[model samples]
Target: MHVLLISQYFLPETGGTTNRVASLAKGLQSKGHDVVVITAKPSHPEGVIWEGYQDDGLVRDEQEGIPTVHTWVYADFEKTLFTRLCSYLSFMCSSVLGAVRERGSFDVILAFSPPLFVGLAGWITARLLNAEFVFDVRDLWPDLAVAMNELNGPVKIGLARWLEHFLYHRADAITAATDGFCESITSITGPDTPVQRVMNGTEPEVFRRDEAGKKLRKEGGFDDRFVVTYAGNIGICQGLDHILEAADRLAEDRSGVLFRFVGSGPVKDDLQREAKRRGLDNVEFHPRVSLDEAAAHMAAADALLVPLADHEIYRSFIPSKLFDSMAAGRPVLLSVDGEARSILEDAEAGRYYPAEDGQELASNIRWMLDHPEACTEMGENGRNYARTHCTREAQAERMTAFLEELIG
Candidate 1:
């Protein structure tokens, strides 16, 4: 099968969407499928073109034998409404043009979303090429933006909502990354639309527990501390203020607890300011690290933190960090509600607190700190569970089977 994948973010961009799409592409290639990824130059979270890469409209590269096509997009790391819109629109135009110029016969076109405009491009290309187009809904788009108050003006929000509907209805098959998203899309687009819940998973080899990482942690002053690390985007969706509050509550327990936030996003500045204002000496902030570095950090931590804002849209969402933490044999400290919490409890991977409940989160943190042995046990359980359920091999097999059915 010849597959064309369209996404704004890709390899070297340290986000869930990038990792998932890369893994899927590689997996498909390994299974004898010819996969071509059409993506923008590496720029996300910190929306700047990666060093050594030029934004010259389009460039083609090969990673692990998969052909990847990168296109130029206007993006700056600044987190303003106007800039984000420009970034999305730029990618939409560039990707459509790039896809058209490439002109390769494809069995199917898969478009991943957040900036749902990519789906629009896939729809247009599929129409032109007479190929099946699958829209991979990673998040419920404009509705999620609306929920976060990111789309402030009423008119803009309305237009975005309309576009969102248009994309959903136009797709051949919709693949949602979460069950909640699948249900929501089904409700909105009707049961007739093919929607499958293909979750975000980790590549086991890349994210397993590492003794070297543990040694690095000890050398880096993490020997005595019970580290609770949040190793992903620090965006608005992640209500990190609650984590700061938890740090404040555990400040007096100097010997036992430490909070490490090892990522960057729009909320990083505000989180740092809040931590300083609260005099959270227990908390430490680190810049976003590469995939290997992040894996090492996760392996070193006693527990991983997954915090989501108290919003209806987030209930169905499971942050990819949770899966990485589980793969690293690190117990999770989840402050997310809904389907995500359900997954943790079913696996017995970690303890959960209500979203935005600082006191409850602090109490859970203290409990984990006191019960080191229990934490270790939970970590082991999580690793075992992840090996079976959330590994790349498992997810890829499922995705390949879905594609095969579509092609047949």
Candidate 2:
């Protein structure tokens, strides 16, 4: 089977959607299916195109032996809603040209969505090629945008809602990243459209426990400190201000607990400013690192944090970072409710605090700090659960089978 995968993000761009699409492409290829990727040039988070693909035209590249087509994007650094839409729209238009450049019929066209324009482009491409179209939803947009206050005005909201419904109705099949998302899709399009939960997972082997983090601990003078690290995008949805407040509350306790952030996003600078203003000496920030380096950071920390803002739209979100943290054999400090909280409790891998609740977060941190043996047990439980249930290879194989079944 020949599969054309469309996404705004891909390998070398570190995020959940990129990881999901890349894993599926590689997994399909490993299973003897031909996979072709249509993605934008590598500008993400920072919005600066990576080196070697600086030209304003189509670039053909190979990612782990899978054929890929890189198209031009707007590369918006400002991150305003208009600029972000321009970025998504530019990729949406260019991805069609990239698909045209492929010049081959596909058995299936799989599109990943967040900006949702990529799904629009994939729908267009599928229609042009008369192939089966599968819409892979990572987030429920327009609803999420409205919750974030990013999409407003009746005309804009009406159009976005129309587009969302249109894509859901038009797709040959739909795959959601979470069960909540599955339910949401089902509610929107009803039983006519097939909706399956294809969870975001991690490569357990790549993220397994290691002592490499000891070197980091020694270098950073954190040998005596109890470290809790948040090692992904420090975005608006993260509600990191609560973490600062937690740190402040802990600062007076003299527990030697430190909070570390190891990623980048639009709100990173603002979060840093807020931390500094609040005199949060226990909180520190680092730039984003590669996946390998991220594993080391996780290993060095006593616990990993997975937080989401307090919003109803976030109830469905299982932050993809949680899997990697668990796979790395570290206990998680999960601060989200609903589906994610359920998973954490089921795995016995972590403790939860209500989102945006500094007092609760601080209390959890204190408990984690006080019970070292319990934390170790939690870490072990997490790793075991991740190995048994959340490997990326398993998810990819599941997705591949789903696609093959759809094709059949």
Candidate 3:
């Protein structure tokens, strides 16, 4: 089978979507399927090209035998609405042109959604090539953007809603990252749209317990503190200000608790400044690290934090960081609601707090700190759950089976 994957972000971007797509492409190649990824140059949260790389319009590369074609897009990392819209549009146009120029016989087209425009391009390309289109919904667009207050105009929201319907209905099949998202897509596309729930997962091999965590803790002088870490994008949707507030509450526990933030995003700088102004010595900010480094940091943490804003749309979303935390055998302090809470509760993998409830978050962290035995048990449960259901191998096998069914 030959599969063409379309996404705006890919390797070196260091996010769940990038890692998931890379893992899937490699997994398909390993199973004797030809896979090619169409993506933009590495310009994500930082919105800048990697230090050694130049913005050539199109470049061919390979990762673990899977071929990839990267196209140039926006280089700005600003969080403003206009800049983000330009970023999405730029990728949509460039990717379409790149895909056309590098046309090859493909059996199926797999495109990811968030910046929903990319899926539109992929759908058009699939139509041109007469290929099966598999639309992977990582985030419900327009609705999510609107809920986040990123798209506010009445006319613009209506147009985005229509575009959402247009893409989902046109796709031959759809795969969603959560059951809630699957339900929403089904509602939009009809009862028989062939939507599957391929929940986000982690590469167990890369996220397992490691000595690097201890080394990092020692070097950072946190060997004696109960390190609570948040290891992903520090964006608005994350609602990480709650974590800062929680840190402020625990500021007096100088030697007992420490907060570590190990990623970069639009809100990171502001969060740092807020922490500094609040005179919270317990909170520490670290720049985004490599995938391996992130795994190490997770392992070093006494617990991992997964925070989300209180929003109706977010109830259907699951943060990929949750899977990484589980794979690392670390207990999680989840500040989310609805489906995410249900998942963690069912798995018995961690404790949860109401979204945006800083008091609840603080209380949960304090409890985890005080009950070391319970914390260890929760961590063990998370690791077992990840191995049983949320590992890369498990997800890849499921995805491959789905592809086979589609082709059949």
Q: What is the C-alpha lDDT profile of model 1 across 145-165, one tens digit per residue?
A: 888888878899888888888
Over 321-354, each residue of candidate 3 has an lDDT whose tens digit, in order, gives: 8888888888889876787788788888899888
Each prediction's TM-score against the native?
0.96, 0.98, 0.97
Candidate 2 per-residue lDDT over residues 1-408, each given as its tens digit: 989999999976877777778888889999999999999999887778999889978889898787888999989679788898899999999999889778779989889998789889989999999899999999999898898788899999999999999999999999998999999889889898888898999888888647788888999999889999999887888888888888899998855988899989989999899988998889889999987888889899999999989998888988888888889899999988888888899999999988899899889988887898999999999999999999889999999889988888
**In order, what lDDT does every prediction score?**
0.84, 0.89, 0.85
- The whole-model C-alpha lDDT of candidate 2 against the native structure comes to 0.89
- The superposed Cα distance between candidate 3 and the true structure at residue 222, in angstroms, equals 1.3
TM-score of 1: 0.96
Best by lDDT: 2
lDDT of 3: 0.85
> How are the candidates ranked when ordered by TM-score, highest leading?
2, 3, 1
After superposition of all CA atoms, the RMSD between model 2 and the true structure is 1.1
Q: Which stretches of candidate 1 lie over 4 Å from their true place?
A: none
TM-score of 3: 0.97
